[model samples]
Target: MTVSFGDAGVVDVLDDEDKSDEAKEEVDSRDEEKTEKGVLESELSGEPYIFDYDSFRVEWKVVSHWEGACNVSVSLTNKSDETIHNWNLSFLSEDEIINPYNARITSEGSDGNKWTFKNLEYNQDIRSGESIQFGFQINYGERIDIPFSYSIDSSEKKVSDSDYEISDQIISSWDGGAVGELHIVNNKDTAIEDWTVTVRTDAVFLTVWGGNIKKVSEDTYEFSCPDYCQNIAPGQTAVIGYQLSGHDTSIEILGLKEWGNKDNTISGNSISDNSVSNNTISENSVSNNSVSDNSVSENKPVTYIESDGHQHIFIDSDEYELLEEGIYLLDVYSDSMTGYINYENEDQNDSDNENYNEIKVESVKLEICDVFDETIWEGDILSDDGFETWSAKDTGFVLGANKLIFDVIFSDDTALKEELIIINREASNIKNTFIELTDEDDDNIYDYYEKYFGTDPDKKDTDGDGLEDGVELFLLDTDPTDDDTDDDGIKDGDEDEDGDGLNILKEYELGTSDLSDDCDLDELSDDYEVNVLGTDPTFADTDFDKITDKEEIDLGLDPLNPDSDGDGIIDGDETITREVSKDYNGEAIDKVSVNIGCKGSMENKLFISKASDKSGILHDTAGLIGDFYDIECDADFETADIVFSYDESMLGDTDESDLRLIWYNEETREFVLLEDSVVDTENNTVSYTTTHFSDWGVVDGKAYEEAFDTPNTPGMSGTDNPYMNNDKFKCCDIA
Candidate 1:
């Protein structure tokens, strides 16, 4: 049974088992997408940002610098295992910087030196391992200096010298030149400040971008990080490429050096650089010195290079010129057609048919939109597949004679104009009656007067009883053909068979059944089950115990479970007593009653329900140790409640708060606790509420001895002692 309350107090119940299961499964599957959408919305709503513990990497580059201004770009990458919907970057610097205000980036901060950058509506979401880049210009007095530390959200990142790892390998080789990437990694806990790396290689006239380069020695060349990116944070990588000429086919990094920590100067170098000068020379002499090496290789290795601080494949000038762009159609189709049911054979000229609409061939021709919808090209479509495809320029319809003009662009950036003509032979008025055909289940068959009752897609109400077939089959679990599913005197639509005080439609909407009298089988009618006991009508035993529901109540036990005392003993076998107290509140309190009784014994476990209400049984488990029990009464607007009590002496300090009333689930073979356990420390009792009956028990305490005997004459320690704890032992008579 399922119950739901929608807007305008619209309540509904659905009772079909299979349909309920499918609905639950669907909801569970969509939970993740719903959660993601919620998080995305929260981020878009300008929620406060928190520090992320995941990894982040960024590359910064200085494009150009003049007397007092410099242009810089930063490529921020998310290296973590999550998608960042909204992102921010903050840093401290002395230079006056301007974060370019555009449709995709924004900036904020009061002090010019302290700046915070945010993503605009266009490019905010960044997936893992993807990057978002933005650029800005800064004007400083003297030499431009980059910020020391950088932060994303509220998390800070830094770098040091030990964090610097270097790699320089040959990508491709030719007779006298080679091109490769120079990759520098920051692996420390902080950011590197004002850093410089020197590489010793035998490459003459080596040109690398994203950094400034100068010769340091006869065989050594030094590279400085871009002015805007001198501070390299931890985990961030800086990559530069070398277009080498008159050098060896292979590249090597013999030694290196780093200096000038920006954040903490006292920390100095964290690790030794990979490049060191062997034949040292002054900065002035480096311009005049050159290393001599000449080698060539045939095998070409492809590698990556950082162009303007962004990722790109390394390509020489000649190869770059060979790259060309062309125009291609992505998709084309007629949006006016309903499904694929067009063109009739007999009524080809019948324009009077209401189902058929008229269309002109020339008006149906589609226009070709350029890539990215840019105006950079005018192209003619030479040919296309004769069908309405996702990428075709027009829907291929034989609608009389027609001609289309196309302007196309080739790989050489040259445009051409051409004409295309189409001819049609079959000419007639077409009736589109099939447009009303439907295959809602995607089973490839029309449902109107063609499919079976359950499979009919066009008719949801097959029997037309004001109830949809889906509602009857899946939700109500009733007969779609017969108005009265139970074959009772009243129709199913008009009868509340379950007598739960709700009609069948209401029960269907609330996911409750209206087909059985005692849906829970707790000796309670469906109406009383919900209104009086507040229990589930579809559940035989609300607590899922092994004992028959009504038997628990007749045996002076809790019908909601198999165990009542919670001492590992079923409620039917446990002895119970009652004491009336006026402190309890509710209307149903006057109807509450307790009865204890004795019955047949099983393995020395006494069945106490057979005794009268006024009788008592006395027995000892371990010579002097004994157990006591009692019951309290209460009520609510919906349910009648009872709190069973056991003294703490025999229960081994089991407090009322920790007591959990549980019953054995026969189907799953596991103990499941009732969700309505209410502890009353004031009365030293634990109570459970249910609309039905089942043998119940408390599982947390092992105070009560089992019915099995020990090695004595009676054979067991617990079996020898059998007695009832209360005087009022009788068969509970419940109407």
Candidate 2:
């Protein structure tokens, strides 16, 4: 009897002596057993185990099955637009795999249920829409269970050195050591995983973080990702910091490699084999089987031959010529006019060639196309001098990579086609170009602008002022020919044109505009906001107080402190004021006169009372004529005048000349005598002018010092007057 498995879960049985029913019953029993063993009916009927992923896909199938062992075949297909290299396939299975072909086992689980396989050298690269296959024999005791869940990872092609950019920033430096961070960015569309960066430097690393480090050579160190971060996605960046025991050391990135994919796992249930329509199995043969040679051979120099069995006519030995078969970088602005390819036919020595000596060029045509293969420029090249040189100066190439095709016809009716690829970059990449013209000083400024601005084309800085001519004329909008455009003694680089306390050079370093004092327009000068107030000049409100800095300062408030007075009210929501009053012997004088002078409106009332706390008094001999006056108001006052009229009995034995008005300093916790007080002896009044109000009173200067044993200063003890310790205070002899 013969059993065959067909497509769409179809099974055929062949038997003799009319035993078809028994064979069908046996097959049914086998199916029931597989179902009981947790195997899906679709999987037993030759269905491939499909693992779908974003970048690639994997298909696993059982080609032939026997009682105890079966042959399993696997195929990896690239689904993305990029080619995959250095691929690895991993899965979890209970069966034992033996006699594996086409792939090598890299790792296995301790219980022998897990496996990881890597590609052979020849099959390592799988181009887009292409698939590679490998197979192995699976031995199982009970039933064969296919690995439905699997993962396929692929390391991308080794990117060119130009695709990676490294930037170093010095975070801090001391006398014998320096700390810096290296920022590595992937400019290309390829993610890098488990990458290693090598740098050549003289400094010895004292400490490192964000990456693992190893010394490769005497002056070289290699850095790789730690456990935390292991990959840098396309157009993404990674930072590695290190502290080294050296100063002014030259550290450069020697090279970087091993670009890979970190997240390539196929999760959840197994995907259907819809993509395996053409993946059919034979009864006794494996499909798409391939084996890899483990031996490695040294690479030899490639010798390129033309299609006509002749040597190339063009040469690529000169830096000014571009006749190679590889990609080249060209500056569109600086190298467009002078780019040319030199033609020298080394095959001219062939005696069989009849027109060797008279190999005159018939016609040459050039065509330029974009990445989409759309023709952008096409023209004919006129060469009356026998085509010694060819140029595409008038092609008008666009930015990015472009394809160039050259079709030439010789006088002997021989036709040839030459191809080249050019990448058009900006003027800053001029060093990679074949030739640069017009800018004699190489300052990135065209000669036309230099002449128009009256600057020397031979010198980068025409005025010898340490600023580039192009930067002065274009960036800073300053005169390039003169060092000082404003005739200010300071040079343009040193002058603070916007009065922001930052010079032009400093502004350029910080990427700030030198012409705007308040770049953010937050109603505050950039100088005061950045240096004095420690606020962000680029932000309108640093504290988010809903008030501008200038308004807060104009209102006599701290811009940094939202609630200036610690009164639980923001400065923008409330008004602050001060008031002073006069009293005699702890009583408000009925004849007291008060005058307030200030700007703006006042809507709140004022309160005047005798201060109950008299701890601010510093002079013991100076007797208080009246209790300290505590005044409060809600309107900020510019000036206030108060007069206290008292009867002659209030003076007692103390003469009028012995009286002095004093104020308590809240911040310093000391007493300050008002030296500018005016006393009217006949009017029996003492008047004083003040800008702010707090505590005020009159004290006699001719009293005994021993009358008080305790200091009157707040937060002090003993008989020592806090003001007496400071030489700035004079509290005696008012008469």
Candidate 3:
């Protein structure tokens, strides 16, 4: 089947053979005819059919058509001042829509004549003066009916300013600035449309957000909701904030008006002509009807000023003394100054002068310059007590000469300038003057220095270390507030000055100098004797062991411990006898001599002693000639030769060559003989080379069988003993 479309609203459906010939003739005949319908006239001329509404306009066009279906393009333009979001366009037509793009068919009439199309996510918002287009195909019986009498609907509900309740609040305030927020609340049952608020203020705006701002006049500003926040739903508030300079200025709400409707407005309160001091705002000053100032204080005394046409600005008086022309002297401690600009205007009510209203001072600035004429500091001065004051808290004046300049500008664009030279005195002169006048503790250290060094001015010795605060800080080069300057647990006054034998306290007590190393004429210094050797500095021999501390240290012995090697013999005695022994019932026995050849420091002294009776190892062996000796050293060593002295009477029937040295292995619970054992007949000692230290004893090699046959040793039972088979004695390896 084939179809043909003509400009005269004619569509003919025919078979394929007659379509080409009949459609050409029908179109040619329709071109010469005219239709009274507006859609038909527009389609014939290939122009769009336009439909106008109060808020938006629509244009419908038929691009192409066939026998039963036609492609149509429609564009929507928002004509109102407010933006339209999530909008729906509805129109009455006799065609059915299909294959829509950039739009969704939301609902259709029962007869399919009325259709409503909603916007897609990407094209939902149609801002003012902006247009969006969409296309779709429509099917008709014989002719396409272009959509007309269209209407655009959105979430926006048009309402007058009376539908909202406006309120202004100061969010925060600082020294010279403040932040304010305006809350526009919708009181109606539906969402409120675009709203604009007119505000009058003398404060300079720094930043604004959540709305659009338009400067209507010098002191009037219009704030309107942006597209995102235009539609304020019921019981919801649209908030906007602005940061502004001038803390003392008042912000007044003049009116609240609807967008695109100038006549529909809610008139606010008249601006207050009264002036308030101390950053106060009057009641009913913002808006009289619904808007209110929620944060400011109420019912303050207002001042009325009679105005003249001209304004005169000048300096009242100079605060600092003038040393020369254009030169003044300012104290180093004076960080701020006042009384530079005149606070009140002089009376100028003269008949010859025109009666003009007085203009207010808009702003004041203070700038400080160095000797080189370069601006060192510049800032705005805030009005306080009717006078403009500036503080130099952040950047203080440099010591020496400086230039101070002030500039005052009035609201009428007239300005006045004043200049003066300021000389800041040197800091040392101020310090000396303060020191001579203030000393609380009478310690000769001034209160000024005490505060500077973080010390207590009322205390002679801050740390109570027996030294004055001044002496500790100046003479001793120590912290005045801390007793232990080096944190070594010693007070400052008790510390040694020159590695001397006497501390400052002792030197003062004895009337001796603290610089001497040995106050008692001893060879040892105080630091070495007391700290290093752990000995008394006043006495020559600390341990009373017949050996001086210096002599003991020179001979590689500990002065604090009389028995340096843990043997029964004293260090002084051991040096002469060349032997160490263990005490048995207060008598020396089991004497031993050790020759350590190692490559490490001996942190602990070498010790040698007979094993106690509580030892679990079996000791009653026939081959053992002497008590088992426990020898140890808390040091790392590769090898050492230990000689164990044995009584000759205990050898009974055993030859000197038959003597052998053996060691008990703790891990294996076995006693093994040393292969490199030497018997010294002259010294009656049995010696052996050992790489490590453990229990050792002298034994007769000829009675090795009797020693190995002994049983019931700890960790040695039955076949568990390594020497149970009675093989040749083997050397035990000790690590």
lDDT values of the candidates?
0.41, 0.58, 0.58
List candidate 2 segments past 4 Å from native: 1-56, 60-73, 78-87, 92-104, 108-114, 119-149, 153-328, 331-423, 426-735
RMSD of each: 35.6, 26.4, 32.3
In model 2, the Cα lDDT at residue 618 comes to 39
In candidate 1, stretches whose alpha carbon ends up further than 4 angstroms from where it belongs are: 1-54, 102-112, 154-735
**Considering every candidate listed, which one attains the maximal TM-score?**
3
lDDT tens digits by residue: candidate 3, 1-735: 322333433333334434465666765476437453223322343444444455666656676777777777777888788777667776666567897865788766433355777765445568787777676888876446653355566543345667778788888887446778889888879755566788897554544555656666656788766433555778888876676654244688876654321111111111122112211121212222221121112211112122121122232334467654445566646545554444443322233435325555556777765433346677776455553443333334544445565666654444444455555654432331212447799766667556535568999988888877766554445566667665567886788766665576665444444557774444777766655766777676667665566656755777787777889877655433222345433222246667674332222357887766464443654467757778888655567788877667656788888888777776766677775688888987778767888887777776765446566445668776655664333344332
- TM-score-wise, the better of 1 and 2 is 2
Writing each residue's lDDT as its tens digit, candidate 2 over 188-300 gives 78656556788887555644555656676656787765322445778888877776654335588777876454433333222232222222222222133322121011111
Cα-lDDT of candidate 3: 0.58
**What TM-score, over all chains together, does every model reach?**
0.20, 0.25, 0.27
Candidate 3 weakest lDDT stretch, 10 residues = 262-271
**Each model's total of backbone clashes:** 68, 1, 0
